[model samples]
Target: MKIELIYPRWKKLEGQTTFHLPPHGPVVMAAALPPGVELDFLDENVDPRDALAACEGCDLVCISMMLTSQVKRGWALADQLRARGLRVLFGGIASMLHAEETLAHADALFLGEVEGRLGAVLEDLAHGRLQKVYNFMQAHPPIELVGPARRSILRDELYHHKGVRMVDLFHASRGCRFKCYPCAVAYLGGRSFRPRPMARVAEELAAIPNGRLFVVDNSLAQDKEWEKELFRTMIPFKKTWCSHTIEDDDEVLALAAQAGAWYVYQAVFDTSDFIRQRVKRYHDHGIAVEGTVLLGLDDQTEDSIRRLIDFLLEIDLDLAEFTVLTPFPHTKCRDDLRKQKRILSDDWDRYTAGEVVFQPKHMSPARLQELYHLAWETFYRDEPQSMKMMKLLQRAVARERALGTYRGRRRDLVRQSFGRELTDEERGV
Candidate 1:
């Protein structure tokens, strides 16, 4: 049997550059496929022109319905592949959001983690007993059984630009313990944090050839012991990686830096001085900090949004990603908005973090959206073009050098990664 797995590009606004990181989902799921299957993987965001090519000569074509930004394209791609007489499968976050519509497109829908389910699906396919929908949410697949992602199957060239690969993605843990309103993780991966055993995590890290990684855990702050041990275990690997962490403790932060933490995705939800202090601490420890601003929060006004941007500049954040407070399906935020009649649209495309889809508590939704756009514009606008490009180049060079991963094609990939060629983020980051 043959299988083709795909992770599609996320559609974003014009002028913004995207660098496709190594996708964690499709690679991880590919690891679950039983042996002797001819496996192929495609990252549509990089070379979208030939995304459909991966389906050729495959027994089963699987495309991830991963995010709101990708669903529209994901559906169309799945339908097109199905027309080619291939059996199509849909899975991931978006599948949970648009299950009914998704089911109509694919031959089967594999819901939630495939740990305990893929074997059955492959077994059934062999015996001709496959089902239309396989929901493994109830199984709560044991974290111990989570296998190392089959990273070797990826087309490395597709991930590199100008010479450096942006980042390799992996998760030391699954699910989020907190039920934040705008989050879809709790419903999808359950509210509890399920971490892979430290030994398994170590083994996986050793196997991944890339030194630069993007740890996809929602937050490492939830478990101090696990976070500390994770970094400790990673020290031997000598890998420099980044991930989201609200870990405020000085000791924990120090340990992470010692383990080669390049940076962390720190959420700046308010204008509190604590935010300033925390960012400074991260800098003090030789770790860069990228701020994630959630713009459509009830407390934010036009002035507040601008003020946050100013604060980000003042703190000299490494980078900032500004997004509207999206109320996604099965999230507490969506339920609350539905009750208050604040949801403006259920149209999945608009659910991209850049667009506002819900009514705000203070300002008009349009105003919130304006601020969101302004934040991105103001962010890059305030920085000189040369400085922006220089910073981008420096970051790329440092990561590539640190990992010593890519060779020969470095200069061109680095230049392209910086948008020297005017490529809109075809896919990634």
Candidate 2:
């Protein structure tokens, strides 16, 4: 049987530098499919065409969504495909979060991880017995069942930034132990942290052809011993990577740096000394820091938001991404906002963290929106976002060179060169 897996695209945060990192959910799901199925994958962010063209004589089409903003587009695509007499299924994070609504637009809706589960779904499809919903939200498969992502289905050439090949997304673990106020990870992946076997992780890392990767684990700070062992297993690969926060310990940091840690997406929520020291420790370990700062939190006033931006600069973050607090479905932030009647809109499209859809505790919605832009502008005033990103790329390249894993730049493709000013057309003029 043949299946088409399509990842629907969503609008990126306007305040950040625009680029597409390959999606991980679809590829990982692809690996879980039973053997001998011909798979056609399309990441609509880079491959703009809808799945109709790829679904020729296909048995099933899976619409995988990872963000709230993608739900509308995913529903539209599913509606369009089903109209043409093709069977369409909805899965992934966004689909789980919005399952009740997504089922209206899908032939089947799958929730929870796909490992060791797709065979049954496909068997039902083959026998014309497809169910309306396969709810596995709480029935997570054993972590050992997770396998290497099926990247063979990806069109690798389409994923790049300027002339540099973007990092391939990989995950050594699943689930997050911490449930932040604005995050739905606990609701989606459970509060227990489930890590893949180290052997499996090593095998996946070795099989990945890319020299750089973005380890897309929800957070690596959960199990200290596991984090250390994962880094130790990765040391020989010499592949530079960026990931979410690692365990904030001297030994863990040392292991990570030895494992070719390039940079990390460290959250900077406040101007406290503890946060300052956390950023410093990452930098001290020779890992570049990219501060992921969320603005317009309940405690944040205009002055506090501005202070946070200044603190980011003071800490010498290699790059900073500023986003407004978005209350996505199933997150505590959304529950609180809705209860207080502070949520201004139910429009999921505008829920892109760049836009303010709810009233702030200390300021008006308009004021919070203005501060969002101000945070981005103030952070990148001296150094353009692109320039800061290019430096991170350079550091990755240097690490590769030192480890004898560097491949000379590929000059055949045409895109804006890093460190060069973006053209008017490239800048959306």
What's the TM for model 1? 0.90
Best by lDDT: 2
Cα lDDT for residue 427, model 1? 35
Worst 10 residues of 2 by lDDT: 413-422
Against the true structure, what is each candidate's TM-score? 0.90, 0.96
* Native-referenced Cα lDDT, model 2: 0.88
What residue runs in model 2 are displaced by over 4 Å at the alpha carbon? 416-429
Task: Note each model's CA RMSD in angstroms.
Answer: 3.6, 2.5
Give the per-residue lDDT digits (tens) of candidate 1, residues 217-314. Answer: 98989898888998899888777788897488888888998777878899898788999999999988878888888887777777887898888888
Global local distance difference test of model 1: 0.79
Q: Which candidate leads the pack in TM-score?
A: 2
Which residue pairs clash within candidate 2? none
